[model samples]
Target chain A: MNELKELGEFGLIDLIKQDTINDHSSVVVGIGDDAAVLLPTPRQLQLLTTDMLVESVHFKLTTTTPWQLGYKAIAVNLSDIAAMGGVPRHAVVSLALPQSTPAEFVTNLYKGMKEICRAFGVNIVGGDTVSSPHGLVINVTVAGEVEPANLVCRSGARPGDVVAVTGNLGSSAAGLDLLTAGEWEDFDFAWPLVTAHLTPRPQVKLGPVLAAAGATSMDDISDGLASEAHEIAKASQVGIKLYAKQIPLAPELAEAAGQLNKQALDYALFGGEDFQLVFTMEPGNYEALLAAYLDLPVVKVGEVVDADEGVTLVDEDGQAQKLEARGFNHFRQEE
Target chain B: MNELKELGEFGLIDLIKQDTINDHSSVVVGIGDDAAVLLPTPRQLQLLTTDMLVESVHFKLTTTTPWQLGYKAIAVNLSDIAAMGGVPRHAVVSLALPQSTPAEFVTNLYKGMKEICRAFGVNIVGGDTVSSPHGLVINVTVAGEVEPANLVCRSGARPGDVVAVTGNLGSSAAGLDLLTAGEWEDFDFAWPLVTAHLTPRPQVKLGPVLAAAGATSMDDISDGLASEAHEIAKASQVGIKLYAKQIPLAPELAEAAGQLNKQALDYALFGGEDFQLVFTMEPGNYEALLAAYLDLPVVKVGEVVDADEGVTLVDEDGQAQKLEARGFNHFRQEE
Candidate 1:
């Protein structure tokens, strides 16, 4: 959760996206696709999203290898496209490196990027490599295609929709916690958390299916669940209340959190960079649309409500507390 | 020239772009758009290019205003599209700002970007903003379109092609000089150089014209005329010799260079950040395709030759000297 304070990754996206950029006719959606979708032509819709990763702030070289760094950079962008019900096609990388960086590190970074791109059937098309005076800076832009009907946006969650997630969350955040603490001596217990943090699998396949199945809204949970739920609420003009007990957390992350004297719910709610998809759909639509795809580990965590109710979370005690867009503190309401 | 030594920008693009990326069916061009072109489909070719600008390395806030920084960021990406003979339609910005950065800076930056986007008929479609631990980093990915037949690439320069530039050179480099040195007492002489450095216009219109005119090879003169010439020669399997007297220099830049006690040719040869298009086409093709578009200020400054002749430059004295991919040195041959 402290990393959320330090990183400040997507916290300001909503504020920045509100600033008016030119509205062109070719643009089907602008800033508030806020998934960052840009469809050039109606017939040939291309989903475009970009993410910039800063060294030390977003990552540290001591813990993240150049290879993993490259892999995650692509993964984040791909996650955005998938959340929009699109298939990423090409990636253009803007890599700024210090002059002193070893040649081998860059090679490995691209290898990692290419490996992921190969898995997703995406091409590494064009890129610019410049010398940075400071730490490494990577900005990746992924271009994808989506059918107009299958396209999803953040501004579609409605009252009475089921608040659901595609997979277990917090493992990535727990993994990050484990990596930074480096106090977990048992390889057997700590390996999953470390791997999850290092290389979080994006729910690429489920996104389009969800859109086709008519999910009301979707978001790639890059900035923790509470922050993402806030974005969806603000965009959709609705309210979301997630259930603490219902929020799915991997057994590995839960076990590690217990050993580390941390709450798993804290990691799920506030720990960012969990690339799992959090979405909403009408409860009645699930039987025909998602029943066949039940193997996706899709779990209902809560329900949507009127905007007046506000985005809140129901703790185990049945107390609903308002969630701050900032760090999650269960006792923040008391404070 | 000192800034060139300090900034080391784009010096290693070739080595990095040379690394193998996946070859996919949809990727009409990969690493070597090396202007970074990605044609999604054969019929619907999309030229993709990305550039990352880092503080101190690319621009200093002390010298570049947020507005100018934003304008130049889009300008650089637009220039890449122009160089490829494509019409830029969309841009995705990845802006990393320090937590201390004022909200006003971000607004003005977007205002500048939007103003330029409006001018060029481009849209600011998507963006991601994150807190940077260090200096501001702006990465822009421009998506453009071109007829596959009219597309220009670095490897298209053939022997006997006339090497031409869209406009006067060295103004941008000279402008950077005036900004950093701050020794320019005369605003009349120094203003153009500073303006050129801060807000050099991209040759967006000329790119498609030159490509349509059957330009054999092309590249944005970003790194410098010498560095760009080497890329063309290396890609096209040809030699290029730029004529010093023929390389167009604006009177404003020439006067400023003289006042600073520096040679204009040095700025033209090695000073980077000029967004003009440097292209090549045969003399026979020029009269028919370009004669009508003569007002574009297209100047022939060099000639492509057999590869064994090498990428070189003819000094004013008629001394043919090899041009290094690195910084320029007139007396480098003397050593």
Candidate 2:
């Protein structure tokens, strides 16, 4: 009987997360991942996913412009397609907003969305716009095409497949920390993290690169590395042993963590919204792929193992440890 | 800033209807229609769209059940596809709800959707469901395949193409009127109208049949016939002259209207939500189709004319008269 206002936006979102029951055969990556992929045909798989961002739930109206909100709403969906190792081709946007919503705001949102759409070569085909009973709700559905043979799922990693990550993690998480902590004085130091939180750069260009390099299984790390690794473990029916020393940490993130007196390793392992590619590679090809990936920095951080071992983390001193999933859980809180 | 609770659900929907703006391509039919279609495609094209009714907006938590909501939602969208000269094939559902939504409700909704899905043999291949800030939102996007050559649009009716309608109109509207008015005494009369309002049977099977018979253009009369007629006229660059006497009226509906002391003709013309195909036929084939359709009478009541004349209603005396678009205008009321 609690009113929605009592729960606020995040509380409502948390409540919603508990409702998802993913049991579809075609779902390669369901709810928790960046996007859900469904194979329609062998040659042409269709990826359909949607993300809705309420004005208050996802962003603050005082700080974020309508354009950024709109762009981010769309970018997040496109990121799902990228996570599925597919190219986004078409998008349909549906919006429910208050009548008082400024026309200029709507136009600018379209402009921001078109900027990204043009870059990704995706068409803004058709959609519906209606008045929202409450706040603005932007829902985007992106349809993508991928060859079944090239499609990657979280379940394909084998025992010997080397766990690797592209780019760094925790910057967005760090940015959120800074925002919540009121560390405005460090604006220069925290701007990247802030921007990372706002307009996430989904790695669409890197999907084919990883696939071409023969990634056994792959997924985007929207949740923290530890959480995503746990997912890969559960899906592939294998265990993962991550090397804490091997995690790439940006200097700014490390410093911020140091200032906050929180473990930077924890952030890198469990801070999500990175949208970086995480894949398992054959150990034999790891060295070559590693060498070839000089520019991309395919950091070998772990290896898949027997399920009996479960997923664990090894410290720099070679101490074996069990790693907790500290990433965002839609239904369950990390704390 | 009045709380949403004050407006309640229906009031909120009315608020939404008020702010919607249709600015893109020639919207042959817009917000109030079962499905909205656009022109400028290679050939005349029909687009069917529907959003699912969740526990809140279209249905009441205390009065309506989930299964009914789901069935009605899909039926609403199917009605759109039927409105067009398109055969339903694929559907994309976007669901938003809180996690607390009972699994039973979700499953029942799907069962309702699936039953309808199976009836039409439409594939529920792809959609996204996420936790909502409040209440459940199910948006269904249906893509029906139509031969580009024989495709019918709301705007293709020339002045000479007879304004003939299939089946009955105003029954659904009358049913809604009764439901809202709390007049539940006439079970026989009210049941059909109520059922018509809740689970509208879309004439999907007949779309192609009408098209193959050389229908000049077609549109589903989701809104009142007059509103849709205006759309067709504006799109086709023609005016419509309606013969009130010739407008098809079901005897039962007439009786119900008479008992209610409501203008039966007005309900037939302006009371919307009758998901019947109001199509035009070439004068030559009109008689043939009319004779062939014995089960559902196709009554010719009007003709399309040059857009300059606008829309006119001819009384029984053959005197041209002006008719207000008394049908639903989601935005006009607000403006």
Candidate 3:
């Protein structure tokens, strides 16, 4: 038997995708999208997205608090809705915990979830609670509503579309690196990256605006900038060309990456959990989209191309290399 | 800090429900019901329900196959929707599996899931896949749809409503007991009970009929008949009187219980995982409901009482005893 690590995350997704057959005609977009888009009613499309976070797999108790765990769990799932240009309306949270888990921890966890749900105008509807033998595991399913015309999906990209991103990347991975190394407080540059790693603000409000502004394709950068670009490319059957220098990096991330003897570009291109939106649009649509969301940092980093070109990244030195679709694979850690 | 075992299942739910303030008017029903009923559109209501199954906590891999695991995972969530008298439309499955899990195991798991989803006209839409360091954990979220008038909630039970149940009780628990006993092949009574424990067919068809016939309140017997009665009583602020004689038990379960030197009645009253719908309705509604689903087994087991009387159980000898709301509590097993 081959190891699941060899299959990689995308390979595993392909496996699940191959066998998945939709029985309901209501399902508009199924397995491969950021969220499953369903036409439950004629007037609007309903979005369904789910995420599971396991102890020591997605997060470690030593590195993150329960509040942050609960907060990030909800944020990441909502990010999928945001990526789809939808308004998140409700969430059901399921938690599996060991008996030793403190009651106060559970309360703080829900408090963190509630705080985030309140921000997005989403309600915490219901969930299941069960016991686990090892450590705490949290799974959140978020349901959102979007107008049919307003929905943006990964398959919408076309040749001549401008590849763009909202907010900076690399800072989150840098933050996680610092947290893993410990002594984060000893360095002044740690807080910004650490906060980015600990808690991410999902592109909730900006998603609909981008969709309304005629953004063609979009995805949340939970799996890194380069990896998400591959997703959009694969889904749309188009190629993407990204400029390395155009990849945004925060000053704190650069400083921390330098201090840690790693390239910030590595964090931007291959690191995970930024929770930013990487999208594509027609060149004519970029100006209005940029002008409308001036409050948030948005940048053009690439262009959509013919499928034969593949997903390629150009270095600052003008070296063009095909980017491998890699970010984080959980099974790899087992080895 | 008190260990979470002391909180009990209902107590923990109360804690979560206490602070779950709904932010949207779209959420018509929240934490207390089988599934959260949301007014996603004015024309119809949306149902969202989530359940998490931890390895060892929910099932023993030694006793159950990956196929059964996946099948039951989907079955339990759909049961919640059935308990709400809704039609399940789609599901998002999230699984956390250990690295050593076989690729074939994954394939069979999905095969089991797809088979069950097909039975109910439900679609497997999207999901999350990640690695678990411990044993496997499966979480499934099912979204269902029902007319606003067809929605049945735990809070709707009233005094004089006849308690109704679909399918016989205790067979599932009895099956589990036989499976755990580990010599099930030796007994003829074993197959029926063991099969009942492994593959529970949720009341997907009969639930809507019950609702249309005017069921006042409903719940699935995931937690045993007594506990479900306690749920309706607590939610509707009513009391319940269940007759021990009326509680249905299969002959196979009784024979198996006799061989194992355990009372089948205990399994019927106090055991769990039956996945049968236990509901209440006006006595006049019973005949119409029964006649409509003549092929399915539907019986009246009790009646809803005034709140002051509390949830009580009657013996075959005509003696009444207050029933304790005890079923399975995961945290309690930790000790």
- Please name the candidate that would achieve the greatest TM-score relative to the true structure: 3
Per-residue C-alpha lDDT of model 1 across residues A78-102, encoded as one tens digit per residue: 8988888877777777777765665
List clashing residue pairs in candidate 1: B33-B36, B175-B193
**Candidate 3 lDDT by residue in tens digits, B1-335:** 32223333233333323322223444433433212333455566678888898888789989998888788999988888887778887777788877666656776677788788777767666677777889999999988777767878888899999998997899999899888889789888788888888988899988788888899988899879988898889879999999999988888988988887988888987889999999999988887766766676887899999999999999999998999887865554312
Pairs of residues clashing in candidate 3:
none
What lDDT tens digits, residue by residue, belong to model 2 across residues B1-335? 44333333223333333212223332222232111222222332323343434334355654446766677777766766665566665555666656465555666667767777668866554455555666666777664445655566665687677887877788887877777667565557777776777677778788777877888767777678887787677667788898888887766677678767798788878887787888887888887776777765566778877788888999989899866655653223322
- What is the DockQ (computed on Cα atoms) for candidate 3? 0.19
Model 2 has an lDDT value of: 0.65
Candidate 2 docks at the CAPRI level of incorrect
| Model 3, C-alpha of A252: deviation from truth (Å) | 0.9
Give stretches of model 1 more than 4 Å off: A1-42, A317-319, A327-335, B1-43, B185-187, B317-319, B328-335
Off by over 4 Å in 2: A1-43, A182-186, A258-261, A283-294, A323-326, A331-335, B1-57, B183-187, B249-262, B285-301, B322-335
Top DockQ hit: 3
**CAPRI class assigned to model 1:** incorrect
Arrange candidates, best lDDT first. Answer: 3, 1, 2
Worst 10 residues of 1 chain A by lDDT: A29-38
